[model samples]
Target: MKITGSRGAKALALVALVSAVGACGLPRSGPNKAEIFKGSVLKQGDAFIVTVNSRVTRATAVTPALGFSSAFRNAGVVGSDVISPGDVLGLTIYENVKDDPLLGNTGQRVSALTEIQVDGAGYIFVPYAGKIKAAGQSPDGLRNIITKKLDTQTPDPQISVQRLAGDGSTVSVSGFAGANGVFPIERPTRTLSAMLSKAGGVTIEPAVAIVRVTRGGKTGSIWLEDLYSNPALDIALRPGDKITVEKDTRSFVAMGATGSQTKVPFETQTLSAIEALATVGGLNTGTADPTGVFVFRNEPAEVANAVLGRRDLKGDQRMVYVLDLTQPTGMFEARDFLIRDGDTVYVTEAPFVQWQKTLSAISGSTNAANNIATTGQ
Candidate 1:
């Protein structure tokens, strides 16, 4: 009886240690990441994804969400057409015939076109027009001013004012452009695409190119492809606007029981959830919980706060979006659902996988106990 008691004691001790270790080694149900980020979990159908337009109505003081088309238009260099300092003007004056000096005029029909530059003080000096304010003055307005002034010295003096572009307005295009440099804006109605083309076109593919524009300390970006898709957004450029073309290398990570766990690049401007899953090779048939497809993202601060009706949220606050691919509607919805930058697509293991793991743990514990029993005897 004493020897039997000793064997029982050894078996119990092994079982306790094995149980403790197994508990420590096991993975949790959801990703440990969300907990680490202290984010909120949102099941599908529980809350709607706040879109750009909807954001305007729901906003309570966070940075307004950027709409897809508005990003291109709002960031694009556009404003009232007005002349400014550093603009070059072509001036032409007419006088009565017989002034005859530069043209040895038999009669003054038309003088040679004179090029004038707007001084930093916003003034332009012309022979007859003399010290006229060019900046903030329209081409037609300056023409009238010059005509009125020149008429004092010459008969019915007519004047024409043209904006000489070379020395005037220009835009800077660099990064991923074949020929990166300052491109002169010839027409007042030059579009973003035209400016890029004038700078030797883009070296990167437009479909995946992220074009960023910066002006007056404000910056915004849109995919080159998306910009072209919307006609209203292809706005005119303003002088001094900086356009930067960069590769759209943004990606999302896929983990859990997916067929291939990897970081998938967007490759294009927009990617739906279904397309994202397909890009990462989809879920593993043997172990994936089809019902547990989840996308973890640090949603826009405004969107998260609106959904939670909270004060404020961190930029890194994680939001878990569940998808049930087992149903047809779920698949359709996934097709329309857009995947954003830095999102994580995770598919949890099936419930049976946990059972299998539990059984394996039990088997290991039984073997450990048997080994302890033999040693004890």
Candidate 2:
């Protein structure tokens, strides 16, 4: 059959349409279009950077400064003294009497009476005396009171009183310790580091250890790193002060064009989004779509709902946060966009570029097959 010119043109057009359709239908390269659309908006846009400026604001609640305040309160000054129960008092007696049995027994008698404890009302129960308020009383004041009381019973009774326990003398150790409990101080002077050693030092990684001290109901935090460098911050330990050691375990998210796109452990205190990108070995230039780099972060559903004035988000619902890195400002923002633990970053591929890859792969396969056929023939 002789083909007419018009008929041949129609057939060629039809073949071309079929080839075009086949090329379009070939598996798309890079990220799937559907997947990119499903991802957060940030992943679908160009990459940009934004700079972050920190603003100073007064702390509304207890902060690191509050901790320092508590430390100062714990360390009692000259006039303001802190007295606890079970504190020991020392006493000496002087009497000029022949064959004084009372004087001979004075040492043992004073020892027993000095060990007496102060009641919850801050009053001590002296053996031969009634309740005596000792909470705010100085050692010498307490001694004078005792001497006056004893003088009424015995003529010219000489008495001396002194506090055996130092003011501010108890230490408490909690969290990540072999034996987590409070310990009594036997001596007057003790350092913060010494108390920590006594309570069994941190068992967890030093880098992850956080030490907090609470005194007089106030708290202060000291990082392990700072404690090592600044000896001044390691203030002397006082009685009734609590030392808490906690372990920090939050990680960072790594996304974009990298060997592995997943969450990576971030042990440091702060992790910038750019640093996270570098951690994953940066973007894969060959297959990466620089314009479509983004980070998808889901805010706490409750927090998002509260901020947006919406009802409770479903259990599976996520608040999508899109970050574009194509613009220079976007890059600055990425640097400031702190990559919190468990955030997801996505990098999308260009549609046209993916189409080219698909067609290239198909053409390469077809050419290889034709070569094989020709060789076989």
Query: Tens digits of per-residue lDDT for model 1 on 181-281?
Result: 88776653378877877787689777777777776576777667767787765666767879988887778888888878888887776687789888877
lDDT string, candidate 2, 1-377, tens digits: 35688899988876675477565655533454356555543565432122232210011111222124544534633232335555555567554443442434633333234555566667776555467887667667887787677666555666666666433346778897556876755442366666677777788877767788877766787666567676666666666878888776566565545656666776555677677777787777766665566554455545444534567564423543344567767677657656666667666655565556555765787799999999999
Question: lDDT of each structure?
Answer: 0.69, 0.59
Winner by lDDT: 1
Could you tell me every candidate's TM-score relative to the true structure? 0.63, 0.58
Error of 1 at 129 (Å): 4.3
Clashes of 1: 6
Which stretches of candidate 1 lie above 4 Å from their native place? 1-64, 67-83, 92-95, 99-114, 136-143, 156-162, 220-223, 246-249, 268-270, 298-319, 327-330, 336-338, 350-377
Global fold similarity of model 1 (TM-score): 0.63
